[model samples]
Target: MTSIEPEQSSELVLRLKSGDVLAYEIIYNVFVKELLATAYKKTGDRVLAEELVQNIFISIWEKRESLVIINLRAYLFGSLKLSVINHIRSLVIENKYKEYKQVSFQEDYQDTSNLVDLQDLSGLIEEGLNSLPTKTQEVFRLSRYGNQSTKDISSKLKISEKAVEYHITRSLKRLKQYLKKFYIFLYL
Candidate 1:
């Protein structure tokens, strides 16, 4: 198995996107060892690094059809960085919870104004929600307010899970964009 050069990896990605198995093999051979090295550098644990590298390769293969890698090396490195950060963060949070029993909180304070703000925001949100497309709004509402899982909504609405996910993601993206615009307008 010949190791593909960095320039060749980009070509391999393009070919893989076009469903070329040889390109996939070439790309994997070139990047897999480097990816595992990055994982080991980030994690400082050989076993865990090996597992993360395995998952990363699996994810890459699974997503090959939709993958558009501008820089395969950078993407792999960034993924390894994020995976390590997530692992460390999870360990920190777990340790904090484990030690929570030893901490004493003798005083408790309550703020009534925060509750009022939440109520006002709830009303304002509902008033503006009608501006969204009906299907998008329904998907957003079911996922956010009705506390329904996407799978549940998909089954309830008789739509594919992908469609449900699309609607929900699109709805949230639009809402965020609108909110940013509104905030800018207010400042201007």
Candidate 2:
């Protein structure tokens, strides 16, 4: 790291807070490589580290007017650490979402092997539906099996749309609760 004298560093920080583009350029030139190296060491990805460092500089420039920096080097390193951590967290979340989507797609994919499971699940679902209140069971049947829209079901049943929605929601919740043990796959 290029060491700037304490007085000079403080002056540069004041100039940066005043929106002096020259001071900002000087700071960037001095700290960019060090920040890049720090990010690269942590992330172990050249492109990502470069992007992180670039983003830090961008943020500093954009928020320069409100920035309060007692020590330029320390502030730059702190920013780099935070950016790296956030990047890692984002990557982890993205990977988890991808995994979830892959598993969901696999489960949804139809195959001859799942035929028996589908039939059994249908029978179990029918049994659970039968156990619901008559109005709820009817609403659920019209919405799901009959593929009728909520508006159509409400009009046909002489009930408000909100009531139809409530019945369908209640039926689904009850069915899921009642068949929780036998329909383990449904939870996914």
Candidate 3:
């Protein structure tokens, strides 16, 4: 077997503590996909995975100054694992509560009520759009919110139809990925 770089984690951590935003971004860029994949595998929810990873990165950035991590990779993965477990546990609890509400409502001759609220979904969608890259976000808004056709979007933005389509598709795919986490919200 090949020898590993033992001090690599510490060196990265040192970079982080010295207020290197790029170092922090490098860390996030390196681990975000794996962290999200792990969360999705455990919970089978893409939206939750994305949201959880976003929060993880935000937390990491916020606490970077005080962080005392020996192994950055291990620390990040461990945090991700714990977050996934907590997310699943919360989902279980929410499901149980929903079931109980359904049963009780049925007994009282009431219909099933939506657990998620649409306003929340609208807010989340807006947030997701704003989080997208500028060009991607603009194309998405023109197509989705402005109700512009792909051809219209292309003409208006002075881009090719294919480029408009590509941006819209990518934006929708990302939105759908995050929305899947709040599938219950869609019902509302």
lDDT of 3 by residue, 27-84 (tens): 7777777788888887788998898888888888888889888877788888888888
Model 2 spans > 4 angstroms off: 110-188
Off by over 4 Å in 3: 1-4, 110-188
Ranking by TM-score: 2, 3, 1
Best by lDDT: 2
* lDDT of candidate 2 over 83-179, digit per residue (tens): 9889889999999999999988887775544887777777889988988889999999999999999999999999999999999999889878766
Give the candidates in order of lDDT, highest first.
2, 3, 1
Cα distance off (Å), candidate 1, residue 145:
53
> Which pairs clash in model 1?
none
Full-model lDDT for every candidate: 0.77, 0.88, 0.81
State the weakest 10-residue window (summed lDDT) of model 2: 179-188
Worst 10-residue stretch by lDDT in candidate 1?
101-110
